[model samples]
Target: MSFLFNSYPLARAALFSMDAEKAHDLTLSALQKAYDCSLTRGLLAAHPQLPCTLMGLSLRNPVGLAAGLDKNGAHIDALGNLGFGFVEVGTVTPKAQPGNPRPRMFRLPRAQCLINRMGFNNHGLDAFIANVRKSQWRSQGGILGLNIGKNAATPIDNAVDDYLLGLEGVYAHADYITVNISSPNTANLRNLQGRDALSALLSPLQEKRKMLEDQYGRRVPLAIKIAPDLTTEEIDVIANLLPQHGIDGVIATNTTLARDAVQGLPYANEAGGLSGPPVHALSLAVISRLREQLGAGYPIIGVGGIATGRQAQEKIAAGANAVQLYTGLIYQGPALVQQCVNALR
Candidate 1:
């Protein structure tokens, strides 16, 4: 384990020093190279024992590489080889496009957090599926969920089309599919989470799910990814609606707009959602609330602010069936993944 860090620490630090977006691109390229060289797969096998199951999908473990890390399916094989039990790719849209402008992503090292308004940038559904098809990654005997979203140009009223389009494209390839309605970077996207709007958005999708199952001869679990910024009432409303819509699960809490954890730090006032340590408390609260409303039987994916085993354990204790990490990986490096799996054991 120390050998991996000793061999790659300098490179990782250099990558992290660049602009976060650039660093992300560089990391993707590096992973692709690692996959081709067969280094990443070996690393995954050599790392920790991270094998677990959720939502009827058998994962090598519960610790997963979260969405937004590989916005497109470009590095699916590469990242899958990096010791994650699962790798969720994309906050994909129906159309391929570059997301928000330069300097859109900021790093808060002091607080071990990140602030980004990355606007669901990806190669779109077509490119996303094509990339996934081209990849040799198969979740190392686990699950690979595709996280889908709407286009930035798509209005809240017509957002259903965008999400549905994504679902149609990736449903066959995904072990499960996540409906991303929580990103604060997209204008008015979160409005769809309201009771009436959620019903409108989800009812039709449920109808389509039935049709898809009939047509495809299989059931694809649909999970909703929501924000941590919602009120208790809003959480209750969503919990009440889940079973009604046949929603399979919930990914509790996307990035937050809160700045309390990174308070007074440079870039603390950036205009994107904040992630990492700052979001941990709120995310756990939202998870607990949803758990309370939905009962213990429902599945929830706990995200936000997880940088350590203890933090991951807190999410599980708070009622999350699984935990994901992005900002934590940024701060602690790949060794964090091993630590999390070992701690869980």
Candidate 2:
């Protein structure tokens, strides 16, 4: 293991002593400093080049830093230095807003889980795009997916407009764009997953993508991020709808609202989507069903509860063409990315 990985427990212990959200902020700042000093780059092991294609884009490896880890794209270069084959940022909205009230993030170390209701808090599209353009990640052949969501104040019925706006804003800059309809923290966001509502949503986004592709002379692929708390029928509806709507890929899960895996653990009763080790099986089950329904050769990026190289491999086995991680990075450090890439190789 790299020194960062072996020494991560002490660093994590220090960070875990603070409020979870504050620790997250401080961690990003620290990474920014580390990037400037060109320090943490050496902390990563040799990232085995395990190239794979996802949604018409080539990736250096199948392991990616999931959205939300660098929601504004500010820390992207720093994170990319940690050896992720790709990095997806955002859930950024068309406009910025202070998300829910304070104390929205809770950690349950006993269960190695997190419950957060951070509600798409971000610096909006312009700032997000500027951050993206500042990065050399794509120039280095690193894949980037820009994740988008609606404004917190947007009405659920009129959500399609926000998504269309998001598509237009991010299309030119992204290797792929993720239509995030799955975050449980967003009010009624998951409702967009309904059969007719999803059709209504994807229709306009697809139409807009056609126009944008014509104008930009490039077709940026779009993927939908789904929630893990779905019934089998709901999963089937999404699987059928995405391909029909011209969406090129699917991100198997976001976070889970179900707390069965963490019952009796502290913060288990928190009101928000739950993630981490507890989500692994639920996420795997969703991936399996999505693969069966979407059929072979379709791109599926599995995420949730992956903290080890073996867990990452398990996701690939469950039908994910590639895999992403967020909470795992928090608990296991950046070395997990190298482990996953090596495992996939």
| Best prediction by TM-score | 2
What alpha-carbon RMSD in Å does predicted model 2 have with respect to the real structure?
1.3
The parts of candidate 1 lying over 4 Å away from their true place are 6-9, 39-47
Model 1 per-residue lDDT tens digits across residues 51-101: 666787777778888899988888887676667777898999999878988
Q: What tens digits encode model 2's per-residue C-alpha lDDT throughout 1-345? A: 376667878999999999999999999998788677744556543455888888988888889889987888898888888878888999899998888898999998887888999999999999999999999889988888999999989999989889988999988889999999999988899999999999999998989999999999999999999999899999999999999998899998899988888899888998999999988999999999999999998999999999889999999999999999999888888777878887877
Error of 2 at 232 (Å): 0.8
Q: Model 1 — which ten-residue stretch has the worst lDDT?
A: 39-48
Candidate 2: minimum summed lDDT over ten consecutive residues — where? Answer: 38-47
Report lDDT (Cα) of residue 339, candidate 1. 75
Q: Which pairs clash in model 1?
A: 50-60, 50-61, 51-60, 51-61, 52-61, 276-305
The estimated TM-scores of all candidates read: 0.96, 0.97
